[model samples]
Target: MEHDQELNNNLRKVKEKFMLDLVDKLNRINRDGLEYGSSALNVCYMTSIVDKQILQCEEFLKDISRGYFIEDYEEDPTGYTNGSIEIQCLNATKTYTLKFTESYCGDMAQCYPSFKLSERHGVGEYEWNYFEDDYEEYEANFNKKYSAIYKDIEQKKKERRIQDIKIQMEMLSQELTALES
Candidate 1:
């Protein structure tokens, strides 16, 4: 009985560790993609790199969900397609949706992802904005925000490049080890 318990505990720990690593990798991939730039080539490269990680994360979630029972499921709300995905939490009785727009026109024109949370009673939305007009007053503010985001993207690219190098080194090390053995 004790041995069985130990084995189960070890397995649980391994699962947790794997999940954490996968989550970290997903985050890195996302950051790297964003940092790559908005050009078509960069976008395609980023998509390719991140797509596999996204699938792995989905598979990992599915594997873990097998241990538990899901109580409720719902079809997605109407008119929420085209780069939008809705997530409904059965346990919490809450629904969340993420929508990305290449160009969103509201008070201003901007390009970014929009996140929304909804419950039975109320809804909340978050979005980023950019200057739509050439007004001098808004120019300074807009420039500042744009510069900040640009700097952040550059920094992320640097971090992603370093991480890629590390991953390559680790793969090489494993191959060398196998060859030696």
Candidate 2:
């Protein structure tokens, strides 16, 4: 009987300790919220709401993204697409076509000129220089008649990958159109 009483007392102490720790954690969170002038709580609440809104936005975007296209035409001096954009995103690469114009009209004008993308477990900063020329022949004309075949292949691959991304961006833009409609 004495042993049973001792065990019960120990359990009661453990429970009290656990409750104390839980209360301390709650107090800390409350204090942090107050110390930051409720900004912390406001951010948390806003982000939670934003999370849902982002999903709705994503759905609308996905629908239109599937239909985006880039027309092939000579750009004027002022910089304009005069075409559509199309793209697809795969495991490690993407395919796309984008056109730029001086006017910020609508879908055709919404294309991003330059951007960067990187992976945590892989290479860093895969990006596009919108103004950079797709000149494999120029790069090959370096040094002797033809410096290296490997460089030529690599440059071609990089150019193709950029095109893929452009396609994906166009799709995303189409999806974004859903929000407006």
Candidate 3:
């Protein structure tokens, strides 16, 4: 019984650590992109990666809730939730595939998740093209393509700041009005 309690405590600590790491990874992906070759691929990979991690964590938590002792348990390292990540873009005119190796799950325990581009079609003819490992060029093009998104995000942030200031002003005005009364 005491051993079980100790195990549960240890599992809780591990889960907390994993959750923190997951959040950090997500923030990094959101800020810097997925570190994948292209923006499209980055978006696809990031979503899939986050989904997989969430599912895996949920499953582990479920097992723990059920009092199942999970030994050597770690986050799924399969590069994808499943075997491969398939993305269709350009009005379904282009398809891309990123496949994970059999060793990928094991590798995940040791390093960050990664995938290899297994297949691609209709490159250069669509909004999302296969990067062919040209990461530097891909990053440049991605930034250029998504500059508007960054601008819009900044605009929204500024608007929120303005709204907050207005709220503060109103509150102060009410306080002054009360004092004058």
Candidate 4:
């Protein structure tokens, strides 16, 4: 509708070859969201899974990713109820949260709330510096209304969607070759 730089790039060649192809096989909801399935864009908006290690290799390349554990906090029960790590996937504009769990520390601490990045979709990295002032409020919300986001689980779910796109594109490529022949 508006001036779309992407759709306009190589205007005639791309448009003629694969308008609907890019639109549908990429699992786009509409013509407007054609970019959603692009590899560049996928690196942007993953549903979950955030860690600093994503900065390494950084290819958006590795298919299999290993998970890590991040020790978020070890605090006393004195006035401390709960906590959350708000993360923005690198290149992604939206934010998702990592909720910690209070495990027994054998009296060393009352709450040893830790974050574990489990094996999953291996989506892109994240930047968790957006809402720093929410430590107090986040604990309140996590205690009252919010549910935890399992980075591994959610990221794997998103990974499935991405896999489907890849499979379908390969089918389409074969179809195009056959048609040309």
Query: Which of the numbered candidates is closest to the native, going by highest lDDT?
Result: 1
- Which candidate, 2 or 4, has the higher lDDT? 4
Shift of residue 160 alpha carbon in model 1, Å: 2.6
Candidate 1: where are CA atoms >4 Å away? 1-145
Cα deviation of 123, candidate 2, in Å = 47
Write one digit per residue (lDDT tens) for candidate 3, span 22-121: 3343334344432332122233333223323333333344333433221121123653432434433333333344333222333445322333332243
Q: Give per-residue CA lDDT, model 2, range 1-181, as digits (tens).
A: 9986775565454434422332233234434444444311111211211221222223223332333222222223452322212323232233333222222224554332221111223212112222223223323332233224224434544565687799999999999997779
Relative to the true structure, candidate 1 reaches a TM of 0.25
Q: Least lDDT summed over 10 consecutive residues: which range in candidate 4?
A: 40-49
lDDT of 3 at 26: 34
User: Model 3 TM-score?
Assistant: 0.25
User: How many residue pairs in model 1 have overlapping backbones?
Assistant: 0
Per-model clash counts, in order, read 0, 25, 0, 0
Candidate 1 global Cα RMSD:
18.6
TM-scores of the models, in the given order?
Answer: 0.25, 0.21, 0.25, 0.21
Candidates in order have lDDT scores of: 0.41, 0.33, 0.40, 0.34
The TM-score of candidate 4 is 0.21
lDDT of 1 by residue, 1-181 (tens): 9986775565565455433433333344445545664211122221221222232233223343334222221223563422333444444434444232233566545333333333354344444343434233444543353454345545776776788899999999999999999
Writing each residue's lDDT as its tens digit, candidate 4 over 88-176 gives 33443333333333334446553333333222333332333323344345444433331222233335546767889999999999999
Task: Report how far residue 179 has shifted in candidate 3, in Å.
Answer: 62
